[model samples]
Target: MPELNVMSEPSVRPPMTTGTGKPLSVTALRKTYGGVTAVDEVSMEIAAGEFVTFLGSSGSGKTTTLMMIAGFCEPDSGSIVVGGRDVTRLAPQKRGLGFVFQQYLLFPHMSVWENVAFPLQLRGVPKAELRRRVGETLEMAGLSAMSRRRPRELSGGQQQRVALCRALVYRPPVILMDEPLGALDKKLRDQLQTEIKRIQRELGLTVIYVTHDQEEALVLSDRIAVMRDGRIDQFDTPQELFERPRTPFVADFLGAANFLPGRVEEQTADHTLVRLDSGGLLKARPQPAPPPPPQAASRSASQAARVRAAVQPGRLALCPPEHGFCTGTVEAVTYVGTLVRATVRPLGGAPGDLVRLELPAGHAPALGERVGVTAAPANVSVFPDVVPDTESGG
Candidate 1:
């Protein structure tokens, strides 16, 4: 991985008002279309200079929420206050925010300098100021040497840098990015993730990023809002979200996990004992927390009894069939990088349900081998099951 020396470059924009990222607050934001709610009372507080990401699958309201924040998609009811000013009903341009789309959206006919200068020109900036600001932004993005090159003349990454310069040139208080790196390849994506973080830090720019890539969100965000079915399941630091997901969807969405279906036999302050349907028991640390309203407070006694233990594949170990938490027949094994991925079917679970684990390189069980999948109590997260989607909206 490169060191991302972009920050080390001489600062282009002044570290005053231009560098001071304005705080943002979204309250009770709701947007719906055709009686189908897209963003359901979505709200969050983003600090100045914070790098926040809206992470979720397609149709999960992340994009719609972002559009509302950008003033492109107006919320039906709610308020958006940036830097203490209400911009909920303002036009996109009037909100004074930067936006970078999945596509570079650069003017093919305009050179890098002109593209970066376009925003300034529209704001009626003087020629000298526009030229100086464009030059500084291009140099900051490491594109000064290519200022004369058109978008088609540059590589994808370079074009992206140009696009970034265009967004940053005006020094907007907040930069809202919707899968800006989605079009790039993995290698380049990795490189640009670091570069973007570096630039954001150097200028103290507040960034509101959106992406379906879990790894990308984990890599670039200081805080991630994990959305599902039009609402945020959890908003937390990556480590907290991964280590202690509030729901099975958050756990499964953020990482590879094995859900051992079971009913809660006992709940204690320190641990919850689960009786697996596959004829085994699991001890997960602490009790599962019910989700908040919308999906919260709706589970019946029987539905509440139906719970699952969520464990990351990396947290599990394979042992002798009689020695660990549960016994299963090895159904599949595959090599992934330095780790071996093994899938096992519990003795009596439903068909198509399997427990997966990441064994150390060369340590996976052979196919058809009976093995026990074990996890420490601290490694497991228990959540009320969502398989039977009921009125609770699992």
Candidate 2:
């Protein structure tokens, strides 16, 4: 991770009248199209200068919530409050928010400087002041040399930087980005992610970023709101979301997790003991809080009963069969750059029921080898098992 240039001294630049950044509050935002509900009562509070990502797969209502926040799409009900002012009914242009779309949205007819200056021009900023602001933004984004170039003349990444510069030129209190880096390749995306973070920090900008990419959300966000069916499933820091997901979907979506079918044998204030269906006891820290119930009745009784224990691939370690919590046979081994991943089939599990284990490259077992997998109780997360609905693709 690149170090953020957090300054202790006051900036020499003129103070923004619109406010550096302000807390954003979304209160029960709901939207429906025809008979299908797109967003269902989503609410979240974003602090000033904080970077929050709305993360979810397609049709999950992430984009709808962002659109409502941007004032582009009107909600059927609820309100959007920015800096303590209600802006739900305000026009997009009057909301005083910056926007960066996936397409870059740069005018082909305009030069890089002109693209960045468009917002200032719309606000009727004086020519001299506009020129100075645009120049400074271009320089900060390392695009001063390309100021004379058109959108077509720049690379995809450069075009994105130009788009970002345009959004920041006005210094809006909140900047909404809708998968702005989605068009670029992996290498370029990674580079731009770092650049975006650096710029956000330097400007103390409150950013509400939207992306379906889990890794991108994890990398860029100080906190993440994991959306599902138009509601937030979990809103938390990346580490918390990964280590203490409230639901199976969040756990499975954030990363690879081995879900062992189990029932809560004993629940206590600190720990919960579970009995695995295949055999053996496992222990996990009890969840202190349960997530908000889903808007629709979608969970099955069987799934609700089995959500007692879940462990990530990295948390499970190989142990002597006699001392292991669950014994299995190594069915396959894959070497992925820094770590080796093994597929293990539990001794009594149904055929095709396998667990993934991530181990040091040198410590991986050979195929057809017998292995016992056990995890420290501290690393395990106990929650109600949420079975995915095949038809709904939960």
Candidate 3:
């Protein structure tokens, strides 16, 4: 871990009222390690009760940003406003926020009840209130019957529930979870995802979750912030990000996409016409235009920008060579459980250039077969091909 050259110990406590969730705001947050920028001008305005996930691969600055919000890291310049109170300089413990980490972080010798009651005990709550809160939280997590078991004796899922109960015992207005289910197996993780969502909505807690799993982000987030390099590539509802990404990185990150490099031949409010570099004309849905370049640039120069049409594997259809938008030869076929995925090598494309298609099971296209691959224009998203290095990738 890189060192954080930050120091602060504010004595003020956060507002920890329990009821409706509270809003969170991050503005112009930036962090650096030596000369490399880890988080660049990251900003968000999260609504009360909204579950937002920071989705990115490792070292993309998602964790760094979350740490800054939790007061575990210090930002070089930024403001963290939680529930309308600025807590940028506040200490972690003083922030009075809930956190559930990947590791259980439970006390080995303590029973579930003792573990859940720990935070309230530190706050010096009355014994009656502490017991009431702990019991209520345990019940909410469906762990009431096992409240007497020690962490070591419980199953992994149960242990995680204890950790979650511990975080919620204090009824913090906001919760920060860092891949809390990363340690579990797929079945357990899927089961717990539902449990976590149920508890969150039942309590109306504002949640900031961090995860690298695209499926997890899609299943859990009300809105997702897809991070790349050191900046947010896109932040929107899961449906919007998946169906209407404005950048190639966003399209590829949220889900696999085949980017057909091209130049914009014509553009309208609803769609764009692209002449693919491989000698095929294609239509794609128009994305929000990128911000214009400097004032000194010429209009004709702006019109010459390169673009790409991003189509998902599922959207690509295999057809007879003469019927497709472009002709290709089937180079590889993969037997995914419910689908047959085939890779097509375009006739005029480079040796490494390949387009993949997902066909229904039993509709396999034989390897080395001649075919045409095409996708509907409306199903394709078009974006500016030139992306800044900071938003290019993790």
Candidate 4:
């Protein structure tokens, strides 16, 4: 895919800070249903004007946490703070948050202008002011020419744009989007993702967007909270999350990875040496270990053992068997435009265990050919082997 150009020229509109687009803080948020915990102690801070996404598979507690922030779902425990004011118990309408869902919940009978103007009307803005704001918002969304059209008369993309315009027209402090582009086609989704980022930056809006689409999260979010089994496994900038994933679940979910069981042989502040189960010594860079919790600092020696290592497919390259880290036989190879993905079964791995490698289309190995796989130490990520939930993936 071509690199995304999200840093376009800023809009010329004057900064309008309705509700001041203030910072949002979700603290120890908890929710449960029928003896099952849907969200557990979820906590995050979204800076004013920052775009943060809750990304995870279905039932991972991302959506539940978002609902709690929007005041649509009351939490069993925890606080929801917007601009330093606690709104944990506020009604959805009283929380002053704009929300857009996957379904374009436009009024079928109302014209585009009417739909965009609904929130201002509810707030009792003067009729003249409502018309002016609605007109400006419609034009901003490039729907000015279709202002008189009804929902049924517009294309799916246009309808979704109308939904976005409606959410932005009132300029609430923070906007919460739940899979807003989930129903759109790829072309439209890409277009809207660009527009959403542009609009958010132009208006300095603090947005909490939720989506199961990893690419979308990477493209749009200033930071992402990767959730699993009702908890955030890791929250960090896109580059950090992908390059230095703190856990196996995050490493696997963010991209394709090959997990090789290994035991640490030597460690230092910056690097680690591991002996793979296949009997190859591999070097890998290590992230600084987080300070152990006060309660766990005094644990027994066995409880402080080192973990396994993982590497991305893109990081591994094919080389002559004697010169590479591990020797493998290519089981299959498929051309995918710019790259050829080869599935290989290593010499000492169990049957059915395979590693995938993305090679340049011109140099990919033929099926059944013996090859060696190697990666730079910096490209490998080592973490404790915490089995991920069965439901977590791209």
Give the per-residue lDDT digits (tens) of candidate 1, residues 1-394: 2111122223355432346688999999998899898889888999999999999888889999999999988799999999999999999989999999988998887777778888887798876666667767777788988877778999999988888888888889899999999989999999999999989988899999999999999999999999877899899999999999877778888886777777878878888888888888888998545443345357666655677788999989988888777888999999988999989988877897788888898797889999988889988887766652212212
Write the number of the candidate with greater TM-score, choosing between 1 and 2.
2
TM-scores for the candidates: 0.87, 0.89, 0.87, 0.89
| Candidate with better lDDT, 1 vs 2 | 1
lDDT of 3 by residue, 1-394 (tens): 2211111112333333345578999999999999999999999999999999999988899999999999999999989999989999999998888999999999887778788878887798977666566666777788877877779899999999899988887878789999999999999999999998888887788999999999999999899999987788889999999988867777887778888877777878877888887878787776564444344155576455666678888888987888776788898899988999898999997777789888998899888999988778778987666543433545
Task: Compute the lDDT for candidate 1.
Answer: 0.84
| Top lDDT model | 1
Better of 1 and 4 by lDDT: 1
Candidate 3, residue 309: how far the Cα is off, in Å? 1.2
Residue pairs in steric clash, candidate 4? none
Q: Which pairs clash in model 1? A: none
Residue 338's lDDT in candidate 3: 95
lDDT of 2 by residue, 1-394 (tens): 2211211222354633333777899999999999988899898999999999998888889888999999889999999999999999999989999999999889888888788888888798877677767777887798988988889999999999999999999889899999999989999999999999988888889999999898999999999998887778899999999988877778878886788877777778887788887787888876553332353246664445555467899888998877777888999999998899999898887676788999998898989988888998888886655554322323
Off by over 4 Å in 2: 1-19, 268-270, 287-306, 389-394
Error of 4 at 123 (Å): 0.9
Report backbone clashes per prediction. 0, 3, 1, 0
- Give the C-alpha lDDT of model 4: 0.83
What are the per-residue Cα lDDT tens digits for candidate 4 across 1-394?
A: 2211211222344434443478998889999998999999988888999999999999899998999999889999999999988999999999889999999999888888788888887898876666667777777788988987899999999999999999999888899999999999999999999999988888888999999899999999999999998999999999999888887788889885788766677878777877776767777886654333334457764454545678888888998988776788999999998999999888897776688888888988987899888889998987664544446532
